[model samples]
Target: MPSSAMPASRTDLDQQPPAAITAAGLRKSYGDKTVLDGIDLHIPAGSVFALLGPNGAGKTTAVKILSTLVSADGGTARVAGHDLAADPQSVRAAIGVTGQFSAVDGLITGEENMLLMADLHHLPRREGRRVAAELLERFDLADAATKPASTYSGGMKRRLDIAMTLVGTPSIIFLDEPTTGLDPRSRQNMWQIVRELVAGGTTVFLTTQYLEEADELADRVAVLNDGRIAAHGTAEELKRLVPGGHVRLRFTDPTAYRSAASALRDVTRHDEALALQLPSDGSQRDLRAVLDRLDAAGVEADELTVHTPDLDDVFFALTGGTTVPHQAEEASR
Candidate 1:
């Protein structure tokens, strides 16, 4: 690797423009087994795109190919305005990757590690020190700047690793399960960092086993299954894939509950609680039809709450209740 340490000169970076990432017919294999089978992906510039799946679903393989760490057996991809294979150097220069594990060197002080990255980028000594100091402050690691990475907590080490990645100031980033082993608080901190990066015009390509993380951070999400993309959409759009979304109608009086239940044929009755669960897709049209029927029957529900299927529901329905191993791995670690 050439010195990653270099001051991004105005002329050097200013000339290059940002571009969306696109993959077509991407495929990869390991000897006898196929890992990625003709996957297609499109990640818009300045957006957070999340790739989700089970442990052996080829999420890492996709990331590796896009980040230039591993060769794809088939397919074509473009990253940061450069062809993934033809101009790999340009792609590498334009993107940063933070894998599941912390890349921080335990023996080096936090500040030194950052400065080292700056040097690797080929920044002038004064410029490298300046960038290092700025990153320490940005990541809230300034207080522990002089402390060796081994002395930092898991969260601090993770933050430092990301800060180092940002040293080169790449416009696009690949974060592979970045918060996999973090505590709730640390995970939230990382989320904030990701949001800030996107807000500042950096595009993020994230892969995680945490469905909640994808729901919370991604502008769009793609679920990979069996070496292929099973589903891709916004969180709400994906949730719509699973059934069982419904509206619960709570009546103030027994008379109203009875009337409402009779009016809606599929209404699930709960006489004791004075509530009826309707099998609704939770669409506005469905809710309107239900309300019109209630009006005709002269029945009114005191409380109406709509429940939509979440990512967990979609995951279970699509994967046959196979709990994603990544989520358990994250929780245990």
Candidate 2:
């Protein structure tokens, strides 16, 4: 149970406003292989929820089931307030999906792709053109709107793909590995677009192998392993589950540094830098205890910094130490 003393702004892990997507006992399998096993999820309206896992861990399967592209073996789901199994047409009308592969037609111009999506949505010709123009400009593809998608760079193609998806202006969107092949700048641009969409009341269901992307963008993150959710919570809450977090105390004064080094015997020391790295969970109680001990020893430090396990650590610890190859490369950089 969480402490009642915690502020209301950041207290509950499961507490949320009305849901945009809900699933219970979601299960799927192919022949003898099970992809998702009794998975459950609740994604709040107008928020970014990230589903994270290694390759082939059912991330795409979950997205497909919810988007009504693939049927689940067992589950009850409601998307955009409509029963997914009962009212798939209504669900489809309220949601958009952008898969790992680019949906852009290389033979067609970016404007053409947008207009195609508009046509699929059965928009009026004049309204379709207006929406395409507005979305193209919003995604910074107005200049290249007339250019063939084949002539666009990888990043530009991705931007155009998302812009085309937005032509229908669905209330909810599912982006599965949306930035897998893009450059760092392009990935960041995609993140910004997600933020703006959420700000405008769009719910985002994001599935990615990148822990950094989840940590930076998601209000809630669920880590899946072996077709089941290993853990689910806010970023900080998940990080707290793993060990190896610590607080570093640095001192400029030789005497104070020496005193702290002696008093804190369990610390990892960097003598040349006059820093003592104390093993801790980076909790408020732990910080208070460390300060009380230092005061008793009459040692004052120059600076303090807390180091905690990042989403990468939490991911590997829960997901059998496996990471996506591309995400690992980006993390190193």
Candidate 3:
């Protein structure tokens, strides 16, 4: 990739928010099998940080350890400014977690589920009810508050699960594959909810099988592969790490196409389509260079398009094509 396509340096760390979560040398294992091997992370407050990996790559294990659900074999972590090992209670108080599966009680109404979470947080009865009611409305579950959770759709149940997570007003939340099995519309709805959470100054730590989810919501993304962090950066930065970006020119006239193709050096020609593809990083400078060459050649292409790598391309490259299978992850849950 060209230097012009690279992400700008984030040198203004002093102007950024304090980290909502931080970890170093985070190691975990089950007997002979290592789950996490010295992974490190630093997520700023009021931003979304996404973790992506293939099955058994320890994405959920990382979440469990940080959320105080499981202990790390060797590591140090802090959440909401509380040390994970020394003050787990404080960390629990400051954070909430919604795993891949819904934690809602199918036997009870959605309102009951919210109230249950409020009680676990030890809120006053009156205040618990107030927060429960408010959250139910906010998540658009108020109308279904009186119905049993078993009757709710997958999307509604997911919304309820998140609403319950907010009952305690946690400053940080961990969502591990939160939208794994939802329909397209439901998935988009969940994305919107994540946006709303970040807008309200809540730092989100997300793990999802959907690459697009991370691409859409994450301020920064990390790829975990084989119990290690392979790469970590903003979406665009990671995308730029992969090659195969190019600028394509298509011409309707055979004469113009031949002239342009002959003038342009090192281009992949599509004879049937009358198109030429030039290697590029999709940067403005690269585009300008291609256009300059075309202008000098005195040939005008009918169409010009820039093709750059997306998250899918980045994920495949970093993981050696071991992309997360959403259905497989969902089944494991």
Can you give the TM-score per candidate against the true fold? 0.88, 0.88, 0.86
lDDT of each: 0.87, 0.89, 0.90
> Model 3 over residues 1-333: C-alpha lDDT tens digits?
777545444445557799999999999999999999999899999999999998899999999999999999998999999999999999999999999988999999999999898888889999999999999999999999999999999999999999999998999999999998899999999999999999999999999879999999999999898898888888866765677788899999999999999889899999999999988877788788888988999999999998888988877876886443232222111
Task: State each candidate's clash count.
Answer: 12, 0, 0
Please give the distance, in angstroms, between residue 78's alpha carbon in candidate 1 and its true position after superposition: 1.2
- The alpha-carbon deviation from the true structure for residue 321 of candidate 1, after best TM-score superposition, in angstroms, is 6.8
Model 1: residues >4 Å from true position, as ranges?
1-19, 321-333
- TM-score (C-alpha) between model 1 and the true structure: 0.88
Which scores higher on TM-score, 2 or 3? 2
Write model 1 residue lDDT over 97-178, tens digit each, in one string.
9998889999989999998898899999999999999999999999999998999999999899999999999999999999
Which 10-residue span in candidate 1 carries the lowest summed lDDT?
324-333
Q: Give the TM-score of candidate 3.
A: 0.86
Residue-level lDDT of model 2, residues 133-182, one tens digit each, is: 99999999999999999999888988888888888889999999999988
Q: What lDDT does model 3 reach?
A: 0.90
